[model samples]
Target: MVRKHLLAIGGALGLGLVSAGLAQTIEGLDLGAIQSRAVEQARDAEAFLSAVSDRGKDARDEARQTVDESLAAVKAIDPTKLPKVGEAGAIDLDEMVSGAQGSLDNPRSAPLFIAFASLSMPEDSLKQMIADVHKAGGVVVFRGLPGNNGRMFAAAMRRVVSQDASGNVAIDPRLFRAFDIKAVPTYVAVSTGFTPCDDFACKSRVPPFDRVTGNVTVQYALESLAQAKGPGAPVAGAALANLVRHD
Candidate 1:
């Protein structure tokens, strides 16, 4: 008889509402005021849960949109367009090979790295910088001016380890705007999407890039990156030190 009364309490009252309905029908209980308040509280709880669910959906949508934008921004280049050798007398044959252990792409990839270098940079400096990035497991993409020396640039690259021959390819102009880069030879540490960046990705907690100039050694810049990666081959003393010591 008591169960029959709760079943009749309009459209499933829920645990809270069911309790209220039972208390309401209790003989001589006179709990009408308390039962009415319970209904309101139950409704409020349901609404709050629904709102939390909606927020989760919105957050997922935001993540999807971000991934799409990053994919659209990525660009590729052909190595055929660049020179495979430097000027007849420009290269120092002895210092060409990087003595660092492992290949150029051997660094830990938690925070993706892509170095934007200019054609205007001196032959020796650019070569050393490229080697450093590679030894530290970063990618190199070259940018040239209206009168840049593509031949010498290509020639210099032939000496260092350029993963996938990307060193011979030109930089995508879109990368400049994405990272807000105003100069060449910028070592931008990016997030997963290769977005141009001055610092480590915010969510990733990686250290940001230190744009290299004549004042600072390229090896130091690369070493800093290896250290930021924490425990890994990039942090190994020999490989990391060799990257800076080779030059």
Candidate 2:
């Protein structure tokens, strides 16, 4: 059984405690949501302090409240640091390779396999997954965590597996916080929709095809996505890709 830890990330001023070294945990916290709410709290607290005079009792009371809220906000998880998702913000996923960019018979725009990886996650394992995903003509998106030394992390990854034909993108760190990711090596299969965007701007939105398939190996991730898009079957991550013809 995977042991999920209770995590508390402190100090947005400096997120030094989180990284590839510590165990990855995303169990019960909607960290991205928490951070957003906290920022709003901190802003409100700051406004209160700026207007209150320090010479009166209101000043002391306001100061105490401000300090408390500030501390909480600074310690809250910053969503800006996670990967960027279509729902959270603007991401031109069309730039990446897709069924439209590739072949039509290959299944709907193909699945977007987003990987939340860190240095702590085994390299050989990740490399194999990358290779398998490419073989299946899937997109491999890498999401780096806070504790990663950018240069060293990429160098390490390159040393293991370098060729990703479908193409890969380093997800916006803030985007990682938006999803309910619980651990490293977690894979999300976006196999049903064309434009990953489901907001008001997108007219061709389908039921959310984004499925977090727990912690799975690379081969399993690809296989699961293919199964998810089958003609009639509707498994969590096992459905067939819902491809459409380009006009």
Candidate 3:
């Protein structure tokens, strides 16, 4: 049975009616009792607000802890010990290129990653960017939970990608700092694999990488990086070829 508290709504109305009745019946009806009740209601409202604030803070704390655990798990992986690109029984490059969902959880890293924020791009643009990144076999990284709330972040991500495309999404601010990404929609391609370090202060000694900041298509970014023959040229070239083949 759904219990409804009479004291919550009807009780307040009844009190108001009683006060009105008393005021009509008594020649000198002082409103001290009504005033006291009003003050109590005000205090109850304040207490309710405080409780809500505390719950929100607890939710944020939990979300932050979850992100931290994910970061630590990813960092503990040793990329150097994994098989190389061409080694047998190792990760299949073709498979990764075709379906890179859950790249955040996968031990094998993608050739490129897209730094993104739901608030930074228009709704249509953000959806298109996520689809494009998925097609290009690249991961899309968000800095953290939106409003530091997990539910809000999940809702925002769901609005961007469909269920199938959700796997390519990840949440980690370290990648943003690692690539020196000052703005959203930044692209980074790394020639060597990624093995995130635990220490935030220490600069990760990673292989050559190419970075571009703008609102450009993943294909365009890859083509530009490959054409420049920069540190990420090799990886970008491969990713571009795979994207073309899949398209």
Candidate 4:
């Protein structure tokens, strides 16, 4: 009886975690729907546990198979193989500043910005955009793991890096919320000494910045920002000059 209960609990928990991970894998995915499905799955797991007493091997086998598959999928992602600046999936802002074209006493003093993107975008376009951002000393930020698995993220990143050798990729979901980014390939050039808050709901005061959203090239976006003469204009202008000089 204890063994049966343990199995049921483990199966239910695994299903819930897997469901959450799967939902997060997709860009702009809805978690509410995934949570509802997870709840239904938990109910199904309970039903399977009850069915066990009635000699219902079919239900038990099906539930076990599902749990096994889900676990396998989650295990497939290996974070070790993914390219990281300091820690796996976490960006080291200090390193990002050092490799950047401009010199700054404090890492945050530079008008560091993020190019919000996703792995779901077109391969050629994504690669080109990454290359452009790298040239401009901007970081490419992904909201989360591709397919909610580290192995898949690593594999996808390897393909992108192979073409552009863009090593400034970072995975941070908070930036999405902080910047209120609703679309992919959005370019945000923030003012100097600007720092995002740790809490998503905190709504800390964000420094002045210029933003461009669309499928436009980074050069076009920077030109628009520089012309706007916003708080981020000088930084954007400098980056634009670097891009042009290199071109």
Highest lDDT: give the candidate number.
4
Per-prediction TM-score, please?
0.36, 0.39, 0.54, 0.56
Q: Kindly list the per-residue Cα lDDT of model 3 for residues 67-95, writing each as its tens digit.
A: 33322332233333332322111111111
Which candidate wins on TM-score?
Answer: 4
Residue 84 displacement in candidate 1 (angstroms): 9.4
Model 2, span 154-197: residue lDDT tens: 23433444333314433332224445455777666543444233
Candidates 2 and 4 compared: the better one by TM-score is 4
Which pairs of residues collide in model 3? Answer: 102-167
Q: Rank the candidates by TM-score, best first.
A: 4, 3, 2, 1
lDDT of 4: 0.53
**Steric overlap count per candidate:** 4, 24, 1, 1
| Segments in model 4 whose C-alpha atoms lie over 4 Å from true places | 1-111, 162-166, 199-204
Q: Give candidate 4's error at residue 164 in angstroms.
A: 7.8
Give the worst 10-residue stretch by lDDT in candidate 4: 96-105
Between candidates 1 and 4, the one scoring higher on lDDT is 4
Judging by TM-score, tell me the better candidate of 1 and 4: 4
Which 10 consecutive positions of candidate 2 have the poorest summed lDDT? 1-10
Ranked candidates (lDDT, high to low): 4, 3, 2, 1
Q: CA lDDT of 31 in candidate 1?
A: 27
